[model samples]
Target: MPRSIWKGAISFGLVTIPVKLYSATEEKDIAFRQVHASDGGRIKYRRVCEIDGEEIPFPEIAKGYELADGRMVILEKEDFDNLPLATTKAVEVVQFVAEDEVDPTYFNKTYFMQADGPGTKPYVLLRDALVKTGQCALVKVALRSREALALVRPRDGLLVMHTMLWPDELRSGEFAAPPETVSVSDAEVTMAQSFIEALSGDFKPEEYTDAYREALEEVVQSKASGVAMPEQTEAPKEAEVVDLVAALRASVEAAKKRRAEGSAAATG
Candidate 1:
């Protein structure tokens, strides 16, 4: 069983469902640490005051908000507690909207919501209802010392709470306008459509691999084994000017050849 990161409850109306939050994803990439080159000692950072040039302890650090230029209002723990909010240890569902209505770009991190105690029946019912309706529960949840908007939906047999980005945080109209109306040759259009049909296949996430990461790992392993490294060769540059139709034709042909070879290899 996965470890629960947070313990909370879902509150809708007067009913409260006790639940625990668990991480839905894991990082698998390699990580590095900063170290002194000469002594091989790890480097560390300290929070220090710029004016006094003195290290500030965690206890001395107080939350502050700048109201104007060079002016800040320091807030203590008690001051923050007085702020008006639901403050309930529950994820309060505000409304339910069609899942398609929510932009995918608004999604942030995700966490699994598991029932804490003997509330399995209600939890399962909620999950099933969400799946059947194809809707997501927009909720307000307070976690990690802040309030956040979360989308609750069913994934597998569990409820997943995905933190949503604020509307102001999302930029509008970043895409370019559609090209001006243009005429296309019937033969060109037919060939392009045929090429698309020939190259199309079911999307498979597992088929994608990070070649750069694999190469980096191989280099690291070789260095660790004291193997001699080969001299690197620079790849040739692509043409600055390209004929779109010609390029598309070449790509389609290459894809067809690759697929045929793969099929033949499997049969062999």
Candidate 2:
């Protein structure tokens, strides 16, 4: 079993349920190490103190807070352990709201919450209630020395927490909006709707693969085996739309043709 990263309690009104938090996702990206290209020797770095120009050991390292006037305050582990925030051992539920009300842009990481100690019954109660009402609990939690806004909801008989970004952390997009003069006609919109409808289907995440990562891996394997790299194909150029309605109509027809071919192949 995967080890839990955090141990805490969910404050359900006056009742408290002990829970363990585990990360719900894992990354599968290809990683590279820095090395001397000529000799294939691994590169190394040291944590050197700026003031003394001396290498510092891991045990001597402490968290530093730089003041506006350039003063540095070094804090130890005890300082963080004694922080005034209640989020240390508690996932404080502030309120419950409709899941759809939360914007997707604010979401960061997801973690699975499992019932611990004698909290299974209360955990199930909360999960079932959330599932029935289609709501999620807004909560505050602290993980890895930082407090965060989070949403707690039920998923497949389990409680999941999604960490959210603070409002100020989101960037304003006022500069990126299209100018007032840019507009689409009714006929173009209608054709675009038809095109979207033709291509609409249930999302199947398993159907997609990371083509770039796969190609990169093949390239690395070829170099390791002293074999020639695979020839690259030219990517299709994007069409510059002079007539929006014409482009939309062509897209709709192409989508329809693909759907018809797929259905025929399935039947055959």
For TM-score, the strongest prediction is 2
Local accuracy by lDDT, each model? 0.83, 0.94
Give the runs in model 1 whose Cα sits over 4 Å from its true position: 36-41, 76-83, 173-196, 231-236, 264-268
Clashing pairs in 2: none
Candidate 1 C-alpha lDDT tens digits along 69-131: 879898898865556777336789999998888889999889999987876777887888889
Write model 2 residue lDDT over 1-268, tens digit each, in one string.
Answer: 9999999899999889999999999988899999999999999999999889999999999999999999999999999989998999999999999989999999999999999989999999999999998899999999998999999999888999999999999999999999999988889889989988999999989979998889889989999999998677999999898998888888888899999999899899
Worst 10 residues of 1 by lDDT: 79-88
Poorly placed runs, candidate 2 (over 4 Å):
264-268
How well does model 2 score by local distance difference test? 0.94
RMSD of each: 3.3, 1.4
In model 1, state the lDDT of residue 6.
Answer: 78
Q: For residue 143, what is the lDDT in candidate 1?
A: 72
